[model samples]
Target chain A: MSLRNALLAMLTSQPMTGYDVYKNFQTSVGYVWHAPDSQIYPELRRMEQDGLIRGETVPWGKRGTKKRYSITEAGVESFQAWLNAPPEYQRERDPVRLRAAYLEWAKPDASAEFFRAHTAYHAGRIEDWEEMIAALRDQSNPTLAKRIEGKSAEEARRITAYKVFAYEGMIARARAEIAWAEKGLELVEELERRV
Target chain B: MSLRNALLAMLTSQPMTGYDVYKNFQTSVGYVWHAPDSQIYPELRRMEQDGLIRGETVPWGKRGTKKRYSITEAGVESFQAWLNAPPEYQRERDPVRLRAAYLEWAKPDASAEFFRAHTAYHAGRIEDWEEMIAALRDQSNPTLAKRIEGKSAEEARRITAYKVFAYEGMIARARAEIAWAEKGLELVEELERRV
Candidate 1:
């Protein structure tokens, strides 16, 4: 989805100033989808002009101007339409993958160093995701927890089961990559000696 | 990384026609990075003017003209610089996340349908990734397997460990999403009943 769509979706939740929207992403939406302040502000402005949303200033007694935004009926309709439409899969362009593609470039002496760096980075990143998986698994968010509470026990269990499986998938992929890098390091070291 | 960078990196591997590059993505890079042919050809034409790469036409009987491209020294150096640079964290702007963000708009009944669709789609995707993980685990690629032959057992094991971890990471994330959707479906249904 475009950043514009994400901004519109956030506004539908509740009216918020551009700053508020930015904060919401950093705190809540940020975990699942990330966008920086740089991208968000420009998109907010553009969306306002497009009639997808409107801005209203709510001035504080002793504060600067804060223009809050809410989705127009038009915006909500557009967002829903966009959601139901077939999703276009964008390429996953990751730096780690690029490094792997260029693995043949590693010189003998640099092989160990490259592998070491990659191993360290992936190791740390995997841990962070694992932690996120754990927190999410708990259904700590009130909206999510309450939703879980409302379901029939069997239904809730089915949903919970899928979530845990997704988390495990991530963990499994991370472990796989780590192993590849480690093996690559060994191969590089051996080639280094021969070359 | 942008599509531009991906094209550049692919050229660094070998001079390839735009068609060849697109095919390469399908076979080798599709798992980690993907771009449609529409994006690739335009990028090649642009990169040519920018001096990042140069293309030469080769005639093939019966087939249309194909322009093969080779990365310039500058392109290679630029790609290397990008490798050493800090990774850019792009948010996963998934349709599932978008739906979650606007869940309030969904009638509990409608929400259940949305969640079911998302859960099924993600579950299938997770399964696909699992197949890939298994294939990689097999390590049947002759070039890569030969490279690994010389490594000490400990080093080989470490590398293997890293690869497995990364694979699990992706699977974990996928499973987590599936779980969320399933639970969300039930919650939506309950909410619908109340309203």
Candidate 2:
């Protein structure tokens, strides 16, 4: 359902070929909602079949044709209904956190190695998110710029604000992970010292 | 696989009836891993058939025998292997965050209502987590108490530390959500004022 809604949201910017949608997904929606190309392709087909989106064959090259998609009136209405619907009950699951809760069962340095990797991983995420934030701020982000391409200045600002706020939330999350892992490293050190 | 391993972890404390496992799941391992009872019972059957856990028919005082499950030697081996394995890539999906990213399409008051609800939700989560931390600290938590029931004082403290650390990570996350949502509320207010 979310993938469907995300696809509808993506089409809100403009008509997109499957390739365009997948490419935009990788850089934008995929950051918040991870879906494989396999998933996206099928969902796009389904949305077109459901009449929430309309598609037409377009020339991809001299030898190929591609299906390009655009939102229908129904699509916009569907998206609005979903937005106003109650948020789904989230099931938070983290393999790292789950493993961390049982680390005492493992060899001592197993934890140190894990936390080090955890910290480094989130450090990279922080960098990615910062780049995204900057891109959105400059209106240089491809998918976002398309979404706001012809809107009134105030409308564009509102659109950009919503996305920046989302990425900023992601940045906060990545920072939190880094902080948690660093604290984990400290706890491991303290435990070793006590023993 | 996480659910299977979590089942194995639960059995590290003691053999339990399926009902007991579900009850404990609500309080303990479920903290880090979320699986409903519907998923648990079938997984329990699979684990038993896989010989990772052994279930035995135990006498019920007056009538039918009940099955209680305990981890087998194979289960311990399986758990250790999983702990040493590389962490799986996690794809985080947050519906609220996803919707937030596109809120410009929504009515101003809709976002205000959403963030207000989001703020209240995290506040409750913070309280729930703080209570969990306190229970662990006092050795009054049933799950932790069971896991450390016969361990040496030093071993017990080490085990407790890992879990307490996990819960603290959760607390940090809840606090971050509160912060994010409060900021969201302010953004909505500013946008509404400008309009």
Per-candidate TM-score, first chain only? Answer: 0.69, 0.94
- What shift in Å separates residue A135 of candidate 2 from its native position after superposition? 1.3
- Candidate 1 TM-score versus the reference: 0.60
Tens digit per residue, CA lDDT, model 1, B1-195: 467777876675568898888987764455556789998898889889988898898887788677889999877777666655544544544445555545554445556666777677768767766776665567653322443477776544544444344444456555766766666666556544553
Candidate 1's docking class is incorrect
Model 1 residue A59 lDDT score: 86
lDDT of each prediction vs. the true structure?
A: 0.63, 0.84
Q: Provide per-model DockQ scores.
A: 0.17, 0.69
Model 1 residue B188 CA deviation (Å) reads 5.0
Which portions of model 1 show Cα errors greater than 4 Å?
Answer: A1-5, A8-14, A34-54, A57-66, A71-92, A107-195, B1-5, B8-14, B45-54, B62-65, B71-86, B91-95, B123-195
lDDT of 2: 0.84
